[model samples]
Every structure is written in structure tokens, then in C-alpha cells.
Target: GFCSQSWTGLIAQLCSGISIVCWLCALTPQIYLNWRSGNTESLSLSFILIWLSGDICNLLGCFLTNQLPFQKFLGIYFCTFDSMLCFQLFYYRWWVKRRDSQLLRSMGFSDTSYHHHLAPSSSSPDGQPQAGTALLAANYNNPTAPDFFEGPAASGANDAFSLLDPSSASSDSPIIGRIIAWVCCGFYITSRLPQILKNHRRRSVEGLSLSMFIFALNGNLFYFSSIMLQSFVSPPGLLLASLPYIIGSVGTVLQDFTVFSQWFVFRR
Candidate 1:
């Protein structure tokens, strides 16, 4: 029912619906993994924050452009989940570390010894520390511990993700919507780099979930398909409005594949 009577329209709607489901399910695996292990060090805090910012912008763009009801709903849905993800990152990064520090104190360990005691052994059977292990070991000697002991740290990395912001404004000038859409694209496109770099740096994807990226890839593919279909037969402005979503959906696919390849490559 996304369109009037054409088969393409029907298919487009179906694709869009599938995309919604895929994205809804995407974050669950990552969230579950973090919860199960009680660790979020494998995930880059910047990635989540940047993605959340994109979702927020997408939501605002949706409202400004007066997009379809479902489009608006999708924007809101993305924003809510991204926010939850941000909370999850903070929970593991701050709360869990605080709890561990408290437990260490109870065990009669002083601040100076906390890092030394908790730091994982560098010499794994594989001859290299796993990502989580490396994260803790690297800062063992420092008075200011990183990763496991401290709050989120900044990193220089680039990555990509997608958050659709439909601009269907016939009343308001579409210029603002277009600009917002580009900004969303920028965020979505670069959101994955930090995680990618983290995986590479740690040389492992432990504490991460492959299912999350898989679902995200599927969602982006379907999202692109749906928007492309809808734009094909629509007016010029509609196509123009849909262009950002298209780019947002397709632009990050290569990055998703890169992550996918990493999942296999680093499985050793």
C-alpha cells in the first residue's frame, strides 16, 4: 500500500517493511552479546554516538519534510534504538567498570595494583592478546588506565551507517531537508570506521556480534531497494528527496562487507 496499484509499489513497500524488521533485529545481537559477556570494550563508543546523532538528525529531517507516516515512524524507531544502544555502551563502560573497581577494593587491592592484577596475560596461546586483553594490557603500567578501567576514549577512525530521513515537503523549501539528509549521510557513512579500526587493532572481534552487522547489511540493502523503487516512478522532487536515503542505504554497504570480512578474517 505504499503506492497506488503498481507491482513495483507493492514490492517497494514490502522491501521497506523488511528493512524495518531487519534494523529492529540488528542491534539485539550486539546488545545481547554485550550483556552476556558484561563487556562493551569491543565496540567503539564513537560509533554509537555518531550513529545516534545521525538518527536524531534523520528524525528532525523527517518532521521538517513532512514525510510519510511510516517514514516518520521509521525515523523515530531508529532514534529510539540508537539511544538505547548509547545507554548500553555507557552502562558497560561506566557501571561495570565501577562495579569491578569496587570489587577490587573489597579484595584489598590498591589503585596502583588494580591494573596489574586485572590486566590479562599478554602471552596467549595464539601468541597475541585478544582485543579485550590487549585493551587492558596496553595501559597496565600507566597511572591512568584505558579501556576497561576508564570511561570511553576518543579514537581516530572513520566508518559508515544509515538512517533514512525522507524529505517530502511540498510546502516548505526542500533545501533544508536536502542539507539535513546530506549530514545524515555523512554520519551514517563514517560511523563504522571506529569499530573497524578497533577490530583491527585488537586483531579480534571478540565481545562483538556478527549477527548485528549481518542484519544491518540486509536492512540497508532492502532499504535501498525500496527507496529506489519508489523513486523510479515518482516525481522529480520525490526522486531528489529520496536520493539521500538511497545514498545512505547503499554507501555503507561496502563498509558492512568490510566488517563481514573482518568477522571471518579475525576469527583466528
Candidate 2:
């Protein structure tokens, strides 16, 4: 019994260490891709937001439920990094929009008149405009033109802006945030569904960062393993309490793997 307990403890420690490393590195790939691409359109905002919400919930849950010190630390770290990613998404979106507006202005096209001037004419050859020309005009005049530019042209310097007001954080009730955090925990668990559906609908993972999901898979696997190992050496009651977290990590692993598979299959 002593040997088994020792072994389980060792495994738990190793898994937790690995999980932390994976979590730390997981977002780097996505961050690099966003910086390189200069557009967050391909990356699902909902996914990031939901993940952020989840991290908040995870942090609070750990604190409320009296999880291990390391687990609580991991939650804090995850929340911090998740928030960074969210901020990055917001920054990239704003930058792309501003850049597009500037380009339109440089071309002497006012937002109001741009679409009107570029609209397809009825008197074109064969009483129909060329498909390519019409598409190009439509893109230029589209209010959400930034959504289409997923290339290097969309890349721009980072902008610093907070999505939420500073005052809100300072003045808002802690109870409200805590309530939202619990809600976000649920959001976190289900957040991947939309992304999976998106990949299926598009049949392409063109804009997704492959490394991001790969790292997520690694992190989640280790996270689940650590928890399971710890639970193995603990009371049955502890295991029952940890079931939700275990399920969450396992679910995340499966979803992340599905996404990684999509990346592989769709890359062709």
C-alpha cells in the first residue's frame, strides 16, 4: 500500500509539472499565428471568450473547493494567459478595422459612398457584371471587409486597448464576477462545440493555428492524468468531487484532438 501511494504521488507530480509546461506553451503558437496573420477573424472569438470565462471559473472553483495549492496556482496562470489571448484578439480586430478604414480613406472612398460607387451596374456586358469584378467591388465596399483579409496584408502593429472598462473591474461587485465565473465554467466546457461545428461547416481549418490545438491536447492529457493519479491515492469522495474537472479535461482533449485531426485532413 505504501509503495502504491508513493508511486501515485510521483506520477501526480510528474503529470502536474508536464501539464503546467504544456499550458504555458499552448497559447504561444496561437499568439504567433495571430501576430503573423494580423487578423483574428479565422480564430473564433467565441472560443477565446469562452475559454477565458472557463479559466475564471476554474480559478474560483479551485479556491472555493479547496483544491491543491498547485492546482490553484495553475488556475491563476491559465486565467492570466487566457486573458492575454483575449486581449490579443481584441487588439488584432481593432487594428485590422482601423487599417481598413485608413486604406479606404487613402483611396478617396468614403464609407457612405464607397459601396454606392462600387455597386455592380446593370448596363454591363450581357447586362451582367463580371463575377470577379463584382466580388472585388463588394469586398471593398463591405462594412466588414476586415473579415476577408486573412493574409499578410492584414498584419499590423499591435494596439493596446482594454475590452472592459477599468472602472468596471474596480467598481463591479465581486459577487457578480464570481457568479459569472461559475457560469463561465459551464461555458468553458461547451465552448469547443461551436469551433468543432465551424470546422465541419467550413470543411477547412484554413485560419486555425495547428500548434495551438496540439499544445492544448498535450496540456489537457497531462492535466487529466495528474488529477486521476492524485485521486487514485485519495479517498473515493475526492474522486467524486473531481469528476467534473476530470470530465472537462478529458472532453477538452478529445475536442482538441478532433480539431488537430481536422487540421491534418483539411491541410490537403
| Best candidate, TM-score | 1
Model 2 misplacement above 4 A: 62-73, 110-185
Error of 2 at 29 (Å): 1.0
TM-score for all models, in order of appearance: 0.76, 0.67
lDDT of 1: 0.56
lDDT of 2 by residue, 35-91 (tens): 666545455666776676666655564454333455456566666666766776677
What TM-score does model 2 achieve against the real structure?
0.67
Each candidate: what lDDT?
A: 0.56, 0.50
**Candidate 1: stretches off by over 4 Å:** 1-5, 117-170, 236-238
In terms of lDDT, the poorest run of 10 residues in model 2 is 135-144
* Candidate 1 lDDT over residue span 68-158, tens digit each: 4555665666666666666777776667667777787899988556655444333443223233221110100000100101111001000
